[model samples]
Target: MIPISVVVVVLGGWSVLYLADTILKSFNSLKNSYENWLALHGLSIAPFHLRWQTSFFNRVFYKFTERSFKEIFQKFSVGMVFGVIAMFGSMILLAKTLMQTLAQMMEEAPSVQSDHVLQVVSSSSRIFTSRSILLSLKHTQVVVPGINLPVSQLAYFFLAILISGVIHEIGHGVAAIREQVRFNGFGMFIFVVYPGAFVDLLTTHLQLISPVQQLRIFCAG
Candidate 1:
Protein backbone atom coordinates (compact mmCIF):
# COMPACT_ATOMS: atom_id res chain seq x y z
CA MET A 1 0.00 0.00 0.00
CA ILE A 2 1.19 3.52 -0.76
CA PRO A 3 1.90 5.75 2.23
CA ILE A 4 -0.49 8.65 2.84
CA SER A 5 2.39 11.14 2.57
CA VAL A 6 3.43 9.73 -0.81
CA VAL A 7 -0.13 9.97 -2.11
CA VAL A 8 -0.49 13.54 -0.87
CA VAL A 9 2.79 14.58 -2.52
CA VAL A 10 1.79 13.07 -5.87
CA LEU A 11 -1.67 14.68 -5.79
CA GLY A 12 -0.22 18.02 -4.73
CA GLY A 13 2.34 18.00 -7.53
CA TRP A 14 -0.33 17.13 -10.10
CA SER A 15 -2.65 19.86 -8.81
CA VAL A 16 0.08 22.50 -9.02
CA LEU A 17 0.89 21.50 -12.60
CA TYR A 18 -2.75 21.62 -13.62
CA LEU A 19 -3.25 25.02 -12.02
CA ALA A 20 -0.23 26.49 -13.79
CA ASP A 21 -1.42 25.24 -17.17
CA THR A 22 -4.90 26.58 -16.57
CA ILE A 23 -3.60 30.03 -15.60
CA LEU A 24 -1.39 30.12 -18.69
CA LYS A 25 -4.24 29.16 -21.01
CA SER A 26 -6.58 31.75 -19.49
CA PHE A 27 -4.20 34.60 -20.39
CA ASN A 28 -5.29 34.71 -24.02
CA SER A 29 -8.35 33.40 -25.88
CA LEU A 30 -6.43 32.57 -29.08
CA LYS A 31 -3.46 30.26 -29.15
CA ASN A 32 -1.49 32.63 -31.34
CA SER A 33 -2.11 35.50 -28.97
CA TYR A 34 -0.93 33.41 -26.07
CA GLU A 35 2.21 32.40 -27.88
CA ASN A 36 2.89 35.94 -29.03
CA TRP A 37 2.40 37.34 -25.56
CA LEU A 38 4.72 34.77 -24.06
CA ALA A 39 7.36 35.51 -26.68
CA LEU A 40 7.05 39.26 -26.20
CA HIS A 41 7.42 38.97 -22.42
CA GLY A 42 10.18 36.36 -22.54
CA LEU A 43 8.00 33.91 -20.67
CA SER A 44 8.06 30.12 -21.11
CA ILE A 45 5.80 27.67 -19.37
CA ALA A 46 5.74 23.91 -19.36
CA PRO A 47 3.91 21.28 -17.36
CA PHE A 48 6.21 21.50 -14.38
CA HIS A 49 8.36 24.56 -15.09
CA LEU A 50 7.78 28.31 -15.52
CA ARG A 51 10.53 30.69 -16.63
CA TRP A 52 10.44 34.49 -17.10
CA GLN A 53 13.55 35.87 -18.76
CA THR A 54 14.51 39.43 -19.66
CA SER A 55 17.55 41.54 -20.54
CA PHE A 56 16.78 44.15 -17.86
CA PHE A 57 19.66 42.99 -15.69
CA ASN A 58 22.27 43.22 -18.44
CA ARG A 59 23.20 46.75 -17.44
CA VAL A 60 23.58 45.74 -13.84
CA PHE A 61 25.80 42.84 -14.83
CA TYR A 62 27.95 45.16 -16.89
CA LYS A 63 28.25 47.62 -14.04
CA PHE A 64 29.28 44.93 -11.63
CA THR A 65 31.82 43.56 -14.09
CA GLU A 66 33.43 46.98 -14.59
CA ARG A 67 36.27 46.30 -12.18
CA SER A 68 40.03 46.46 -12.53
CA PHE A 69 41.56 43.49 -14.33
CA LYS A 70 43.60 42.62 -11.24
CA GLU A 71 40.54 42.68 -9.00
CA ILE A 72 38.46 40.53 -11.37
CA PHE A 73 41.25 38.04 -11.83
CA GLN A 74 41.90 37.78 -8.10
CA LYS A 75 38.21 37.20 -7.29
CA PHE A 76 37.78 34.41 -9.83
CA SER A 77 41.12 32.90 -8.99
CA VAL A 78 40.14 32.54 -5.34
CA GLY A 79 36.77 31.11 -6.29
CA MET A 80 38.41 28.57 -8.59
CA VAL A 81 40.82 27.50 -5.87
CA PHE A 82 38.02 26.96 -3.33
CA GLY A 83 35.86 25.15 -5.91
CA VAL A 84 38.70 22.76 -6.68
CA ILE A 85 39.31 22.12 -3.00
CA ALA A 86 35.64 21.39 -2.34
CA MET A 87 35.45 19.06 -5.36
CA PHE A 88 38.48 17.07 -4.24
CA GLY A 89 37.25 16.93 -0.63
CA SER A 90 33.90 15.50 -1.71
CA MET A 91 35.63 12.93 -3.93
CA ILE A 92 37.85 11.80 -1.08
CA LEU A 93 34.87 11.44 1.29
CA LEU A 94 32.95 9.37 -1.31
CA ALA A 95 35.99 7.17 -1.91
CA LYS A 96 36.40 6.57 1.82
CA THR A 97 32.72 5.66 2.17
CA LEU A 98 32.93 3.18 -0.73
CA MET A 99 36.01 1.53 0.70
CA GLN A 100 34.32 1.15 4.09
CA THR A 101 31.22 -0.33 2.47
CA LEU A 102 33.26 -2.86 0.49
CA ALA A 103 35.27 -3.86 3.54
CA GLN A 104 32.10 -4.46 5.58
CA MET A 105 30.53 -6.50 2.76
CA MET A 106 33.56 -8.74 2.49
CA GLU A 107 33.66 -9.27 6.24
CA GLU A 108 29.99 -10.24 6.34
CA ALA A 109 30.16 -12.49 3.26
CA PRO A 110 32.26 -15.13 5.00
CA SER A 111 29.83 -15.32 7.94
CA VAL A 112 26.85 -16.55 5.90
CA GLN A 113 26.11 -20.14 6.94
CA SER A 114 24.46 -22.80 4.82
CA ASP A 115 22.02 -23.65 7.63
CA HIS A 116 20.94 -20.01 7.86
CA VAL A 117 20.68 -19.34 4.17
CA LEU A 118 17.21 -17.81 4.41
CA GLN A 119 18.28 -15.39 7.14
CA VAL A 120 21.42 -14.46 5.24
CA VAL A 121 19.44 -13.94 2.05
CA SER A 122 16.98 -11.67 3.79
CA SER A 123 19.76 -9.60 5.34
CA SER A 124 21.76 -9.55 2.13
CA SER A 125 19.05 -7.46 0.47
CA ARG A 126 20.81 -4.50 2.05
CA ILE A 127 24.16 -4.28 0.27
CA PHE A 128 25.49 -1.61 2.62
CA THR A 129 25.35 -2.37 6.31
CA SER A 130 24.45 0.17 8.98
CA ARG A 131 28.14 0.57 9.81
CA SER A 132 29.03 1.67 6.29
CA ILE A 133 28.22 4.70 4.14
CA LEU A 134 24.50 4.23 4.70
CA LEU A 135 24.99 4.94 8.39
CA SER A 136 25.28 8.66 7.69
CA LEU A 137 22.76 8.75 4.85
CA LYS A 138 20.09 6.87 6.80
CA HIS A 139 19.91 9.68 9.34
CA THR A 140 19.54 12.41 6.71
CA GLN A 141 15.93 13.50 6.31
CA VAL A 142 14.04 15.44 3.63
CA VAL A 143 12.31 18.63 4.79
CA VAL A 144 8.70 17.86 3.88
CA PRO A 145 6.07 20.30 5.07
CA GLY A 146 3.71 18.94 7.75
CA ILE A 147 6.03 16.00 8.16
CA ASN A 148 9.69 16.41 9.07
CA LEU A 149 9.43 20.18 8.67
CA PRO A 150 6.87 22.67 9.93
CA VAL A 151 4.60 24.09 7.25
CA SER A 152 5.33 27.64 8.42
CA GLN A 153 9.05 27.20 7.78
CA LEU A 154 8.49 26.15 4.20
CA ALA A 155 8.21 29.75 3.01
CA TYR A 156 11.51 30.66 4.64
CA PHE A 157 13.15 27.61 3.05
CA PHE A 158 11.91 28.59 -0.40
CA LEU A 159 12.98 32.19 0.10
CA ALA A 160 16.48 31.11 1.08
CA ILE A 161 16.73 28.90 -1.98
CA LEU A 162 15.57 31.74 -4.25
CA ILE A 163 18.06 34.20 -2.77
CA SER A 164 20.93 31.75 -3.12
CA GLY A 165 19.98 30.93 -6.69
CA VAL A 166 19.73 34.60 -7.63
CA ILE A 167 23.16 35.32 -6.17
CA HIS A 168 24.63 32.33 -8.01
CA GLU A 169 23.18 33.51 -11.33
CA ILE A 170 24.37 37.06 -10.68
CA GLY A 171 27.87 35.71 -10.15
CA HIS A 172 27.75 33.93 -13.49
CA GLY A 173 26.41 37.02 -15.25
CA VAL A 174 29.14 39.23 -13.85
CA ALA A 175 31.83 36.73 -14.84
CA ALA A 176 30.44 36.42 -18.34
CA ILE A 177 30.27 40.18 -18.82
CA ARG A 178 33.79 40.56 -17.44
CA GLU A 179 35.01 38.04 -19.99
CA GLN A 180 33.50 40.18 -22.80
CA VAL A 181 30.83 37.54 -23.50
CA ARG A 182 27.35 38.66 -24.52
CA PHE A 183 25.07 38.49 -21.50
CA ASN A 184 21.68 37.63 -23.01
CA GLY A 185 19.33 37.57 -20.02
CA PHE A 186 18.50 36.28 -16.57
CA GLY A 187 15.75 33.80 -15.75
CA MET A 188 14.26 32.05 -12.77
CA PHE A 189 12.11 28.93 -12.70
CA ILE A 190 10.31 26.60 -10.40
CA PHE A 191 10.38 22.92 -11.31
CA VAL A 192 8.01 21.02 -9.08
CA VAL A 193 9.34 22.07 -5.66
CA TYR A 194 12.88 23.16 -6.57
CA PRO A 195 13.60 26.79 -7.44
CA GLY A 196 16.57 27.81 -9.60
CA ALA A 197 17.97 30.79 -11.49
CA PHE A 198 20.13 30.98 -14.58
CA VAL A 199 22.11 33.57 -16.58
CA ASP A 200 21.82 33.25 -20.32
CA LEU A 201 25.02 33.94 -22.25
CA LEU A 202 25.45 33.66 -26.01
CA THR A 203 26.75 30.19 -26.87
CA THR A 204 28.87 31.52 -29.72
CA HIS A 205 30.50 34.10 -27.47
CA LEU A 206 31.16 31.52 -24.77
CA GLN A 207 32.75 29.18 -27.28
CA LEU A 208 34.95 31.93 -28.70
CA ILE A 209 36.36 32.88 -25.29
CA SER A 210 39.65 31.54 -23.98
CA PRO A 211 39.62 28.42 -21.77
CA VAL A 212 40.62 30.43 -18.69
CA GLN A 213 37.73 32.84 -19.22
CA GLN A 214 35.34 29.93 -19.65
CA LEU A 215 36.58 28.43 -16.41
CA ARG A 216 35.85 31.68 -14.58
CA ILE A 217 32.30 31.82 -15.91
CA PHE A 218 31.61 28.19 -15.13
CA CYS A 219 33.03 28.36 -11.63
CA ALA A 220 31.33 31.65 -10.81
CA GLY A 221 28.15 29.81 -10.03
Candidate 2:
Protein backbone atom coordinates (compact mmCIF):
# COMPACT_ATOMS: atom_id res chain seq x y z
CA MET A 1 0.00 0.00 0.00
CA ILE A 2 1.03 3.63 -0.33
CA PRO A 3 0.80 4.08 3.43
CA ILE A 4 -2.21 5.09 5.52
CA SER A 5 -1.26 8.74 5.68
CA VAL A 6 -0.90 8.91 1.94
CA VAL A 7 -4.48 7.86 1.27
CA VAL A 8 -5.97 10.16 3.84
CA VAL A 9 -3.63 13.03 3.15
CA VAL A 10 -4.39 12.67 -0.51
CA LEU A 11 -8.10 12.31 0.08
CA GLY A 12 -8.28 15.20 2.51
CA GLY A 13 -5.84 17.20 0.47
CA TRP A 14 -7.61 16.54 -2.79
CA SER A 15 -11.00 17.06 -1.27
CA VAL A 16 -10.03 20.64 -0.59
CA LEU A 17 -8.44 20.93 -3.97
CA TYR A 18 -11.47 19.47 -5.66
CA LEU A 19 -13.81 21.73 -3.75
CA ALA A 20 -11.75 24.74 -4.74
CA ASP A 21 -11.56 23.40 -8.20
CA THR A 22 -15.30 23.00 -8.40
CA ILE A 23 -15.92 26.42 -7.00
CA LEU A 24 -13.43 27.99 -9.36
CA LYS A 25 -14.66 25.98 -12.27
CA SER A 26 -18.15 27.17 -11.57
CA PHE A 27 -17.17 30.75 -10.80
CA ASN A 28 -18.03 32.03 -14.21
CA SER A 29 -21.18 30.01 -14.17
CA LEU A 30 -22.37 31.21 -10.76
CA LYS A 31 -24.82 34.08 -10.42
CA ASN A 32 -23.23 37.50 -10.14
CA SER A 33 -23.94 38.40 -6.51
CA TYR A 34 -22.95 35.14 -4.88
CA GLU A 35 -19.85 34.81 -6.99
CA ASN A 36 -18.92 38.38 -6.33
CA TRP A 37 -19.05 37.91 -2.58
CA LEU A 38 -16.74 34.93 -2.77
CA ALA A 39 -14.34 36.82 -5.00
CA LEU A 40 -14.37 39.94 -2.87
CA HIS A 41 -12.98 38.34 0.23
CA GLY A 42 -12.07 34.97 -1.18
CA LEU A 43 -8.44 35.76 -0.61
CA SER A 44 -9.18 36.07 3.07
CA ILE A 45 -9.92 32.33 3.22
CA ALA A 46 -6.35 31.45 2.65
CA PRO A 47 -4.19 29.11 4.82
CA PHE A 48 -7.41 27.37 5.95
CA HIS A 49 -10.88 26.72 4.57
CA LEU A 50 -11.60 23.05 5.02
CA ARG A 51 -15.01 23.58 6.56
CA TRP A 52 -16.51 23.15 3.15
CA GLN A 53 -14.46 20.01 2.88
CA THR A 54 -16.82 18.58 5.45
CA SER A 55 -19.77 20.94 5.28
CA PHE A 56 -22.55 18.38 5.10
CA PHE A 57 -20.85 16.38 7.79
CA ASN A 58 -20.39 19.55 9.82
CA ARG A 59 -24.05 20.48 9.37
CA VAL A 60 -25.22 17.14 10.71
CA PHE A 61 -22.74 17.23 13.57
CA TYR A 62 -23.74 20.71 14.75
CA LYS A 63 -27.16 19.35 15.78
CA PHE A 64 -25.24 18.13 18.79
CA THR A 65 -23.91 21.66 19.24
CA GLU A 66 -25.00 22.13 22.78
CA ARG A 67 -21.48 22.45 24.12
CA SER A 68 -19.64 25.76 24.49
CA PHE A 69 -16.75 26.35 22.10
CA LYS A 70 -14.14 26.97 24.76
CA GLU A 71 -14.97 23.74 26.52
CA ILE A 72 -14.89 21.77 23.32
CA PHE A 73 -11.67 23.38 22.13
CA GLN A 74 -9.94 22.77 25.43
CA LYS A 75 -10.96 19.14 25.45
CA PHE A 76 -10.18 18.41 21.81
CA SER A 77 -7.01 20.42 21.72
CA VAL A 78 -5.64 18.43 24.61
CA GLY A 79 -6.75 15.20 23.00
CA MET A 80 -5.28 16.04 19.63
CA VAL A 81 -1.99 17.16 21.15
CA PHE A 82 -1.79 13.82 22.93
CA GLY A 83 -2.97 11.80 19.95
CA VAL A 84 -0.42 13.44 17.71
CA ILE A 85 2.23 12.72 20.26
CA ALA A 86 1.26 9.06 20.60
CA MET A 87 1.01 8.59 16.88
CA PHE A 88 3.93 10.70 15.73
CA GLY A 89 6.20 10.77 18.72
CA SER A 90 5.44 14.25 19.98
CA MET A 91 5.97 15.89 16.59
CA ILE A 92 9.72 15.94 17.15
CA LEU A 93 9.95 12.24 16.45
CA LEU A 94 7.48 12.55 13.61
CA ALA A 95 9.50 15.37 12.17
CA LYS A 96 12.65 13.26 12.22
CA THR A 97 10.83 10.33 10.66
CA LEU A 98 8.84 12.11 7.96
CA MET A 99 11.65 14.29 6.68
CA GLN A 100 11.81 11.97 3.72
CA THR A 101 8.08 11.99 3.14
CA LEU A 102 8.03 15.74 3.33
CA ALA A 103 10.83 16.01 0.83
CA GLN A 104 9.14 13.61 -1.55
CA MET A 105 5.58 14.97 -1.25
CA MET A 106 6.83 18.47 -1.80
CA GLU A 107 9.13 17.52 -4.63
CA GLU A 108 6.27 15.68 -6.25
CA ALA A 109 3.76 18.39 -5.48
CA PRO A 110 3.56 21.29 -7.89
CA SER A 111 5.68 23.94 -6.25
CA VAL A 112 6.81 26.00 -9.20
CA GLN A 113 3.70 26.70 -11.20
CA SER A 114 3.36 30.21 -9.84
CA ASP A 115 3.70 32.66 -12.69
CA HIS A 116 1.58 35.75 -12.31
CA VAL A 117 -0.32 37.12 -15.28
CA LEU A 118 -1.79 40.60 -15.11
CA GLN A 119 -3.74 41.32 -11.87
CA VAL A 120 -5.18 37.82 -11.68
CA VAL A 121 -2.12 35.95 -10.44
CA SER A 122 -1.65 38.20 -7.43
CA SER A 123 -5.22 37.67 -6.27
CA SER A 124 -6.43 34.10 -5.94
CA SER A 125 -6.03 30.80 -4.05
CA ARG A 126 -6.07 28.68 -7.21
CA ILE A 127 -2.78 30.12 -8.33
CA PHE A 128 -0.73 29.02 -5.37
CA THR A 129 -1.66 25.33 -5.31
CA SER A 130 -0.02 25.02 -1.94
CA ARG A 131 -1.05 22.07 0.18
CA SER A 132 -3.84 23.41 2.32
CA ILE A 133 -2.66 24.09 5.82
CA LEU A 134 -5.85 22.39 6.95
CA LEU A 135 -5.05 19.15 5.12
CA SER A 136 -1.38 19.13 6.09
CA LEU A 137 -1.77 16.69 8.94
CA LYS A 138 0.87 14.49 10.49
CA HIS A 139 0.56 11.34 12.63
CA THR A 140 -1.24 8.01 12.27
CA GLN A 141 1.11 6.58 9.73
CA VAL A 142 0.09 2.91 9.51
CA VAL A 143 2.44 2.07 6.68
CA VAL A 144 5.83 2.89 5.21
CA PRO A 145 5.50 2.94 1.46
CA GLY A 146 7.77 0.12 0.14
CA ILE A 147 6.63 -1.35 3.44
CA ASN A 148 3.02 -0.95 2.25
CA LEU A 149 0.19 0.64 4.31
CA PRO A 150 -2.94 2.76 3.99
CA VAL A 151 -3.60 6.31 5.22
CA SER A 152 -7.08 5.32 6.36
CA GLN A 153 -5.98 5.54 9.97
CA LEU A 154 -5.45 9.22 9.48
CA ALA A 155 -8.90 9.55 7.93
CA TYR A 156 -10.72 9.38 11.22
CA PHE A 157 -7.84 11.16 12.87
CA PHE A 158 -8.15 14.00 10.40
CA LEU A 159 -11.93 13.89 10.39
CA ALA A 160 -11.98 14.55 14.10
CA ILE A 161 -9.40 17.30 13.83
CA LEU A 162 -11.09 18.81 10.83
CA ILE A 163 -14.61 18.65 12.20
CA SER A 164 -13.52 19.94 15.57
CA GLY A 165 -11.80 22.83 13.89
CA VAL A 166 -14.75 23.65 11.68
CA ILE A 167 -17.13 23.57 14.62
CA HIS A 168 -14.82 25.80 16.61
CA GLU A 169 -14.76 28.54 14.01
CA ILE A 170 -18.36 28.24 12.96
CA GLY A 171 -19.39 28.32 16.54
CA HIS A 172 -17.56 31.59 16.83
CA GLY A 173 -19.30 32.95 13.78
CA VAL A 174 -22.68 31.66 14.87
CA ALA A 175 -22.29 33.05 18.34
CA ALA A 176 -21.19 36.35 16.91
CA ILE A 177 -24.07 36.51 14.46
CA ARG A 178 -26.56 35.40 17.06
CA GLU A 179 -25.25 38.04 19.43
CA GLN A 180 -25.50 40.60 16.63
CA VAL A 181 -21.81 41.45 16.61
CA ARG A 182 -19.97 42.55 13.53
CA PHE A 183 -18.37 40.01 11.24
CA ASN A 184 -14.90 41.26 10.53
CA GLY A 185 -14.10 37.72 9.40
CA PHE A 186 -12.65 34.37 10.37
CA GLY A 187 -9.66 32.48 9.00
CA MET A 188 -7.88 29.16 8.89
CA PHE A 189 -4.32 28.45 9.91
CA ILE A 190 -1.92 25.55 10.23
CA PHE A 191 0.64 24.62 12.80
CA VAL A 192 2.71 21.90 11.17
CA VAL A 193 0.23 19.64 9.35
CA TYR A 194 -2.55 19.82 11.90
CA PRO A 195 -5.19 22.38 11.00
CA GLY A 196 -6.58 25.17 13.20
CA ALA A 197 -9.73 27.21 12.81
CA PHE A 198 -9.54 30.65 14.37
CA VAL A 199 -11.89 33.57 14.38
CA ASP A 200 -10.74 37.18 14.16
CA LEU A 201 -10.75 37.67 17.90
CA LEU A 202 -9.33 41.19 17.86
CA THR A 203 -11.79 42.42 15.31
CA THR A 204 -14.49 40.44 17.02
CA HIS A 205 -13.63 42.17 20.25
CA LEU A 206 -13.88 45.58 18.68
CA GLN A 207 -17.10 44.80 16.90
CA LEU A 208 -18.88 43.34 19.90
CA ILE A 209 -21.48 45.73 21.26
CA SER A 210 -21.39 44.48 24.85
CA PRO A 211 -19.74 42.15 27.26
CA VAL A 212 -22.61 39.70 27.13
CA GLN A 213 -22.31 39.52 23.36
CA GLN A 214 -18.55 39.22 23.56
CA LEU A 215 -18.96 36.57 26.17
CA ARG A 216 -21.29 34.71 23.90
CA ILE A 217 -18.88 34.76 21.00
CA PHE A 218 -15.80 34.11 23.10
CA CYS A 219 -17.32 31.18 24.91
CA ALA A 220 -18.61 29.66 21.72
CA GLY A 221 -15.21 29.52 19.97
Q: lDDT of each prediction vs. the true structure?
A: 0.74, 0.50
lDDT of 2: 0.50
- Per-model TM-score, in order, reads 0.69, 0.32
lDDT of 1 by residue, 71-188 (tens): 8778987887787788998886776565445444445655454225434434675644443443344333435665676665767888899999999988888888888899899999
Stretches > 4 Å off in candidate 1: 1-29, 67-69, 93-151
Over all chains combined, what TM-score does candidate 2 have? 0.32
Top model by lDDT, which number? 1
Q: Candidate 1: lDDT over CA atoms?
A: 0.74
Distance (Å) between predicted and true CA of 145, model 2?
Answer: 17
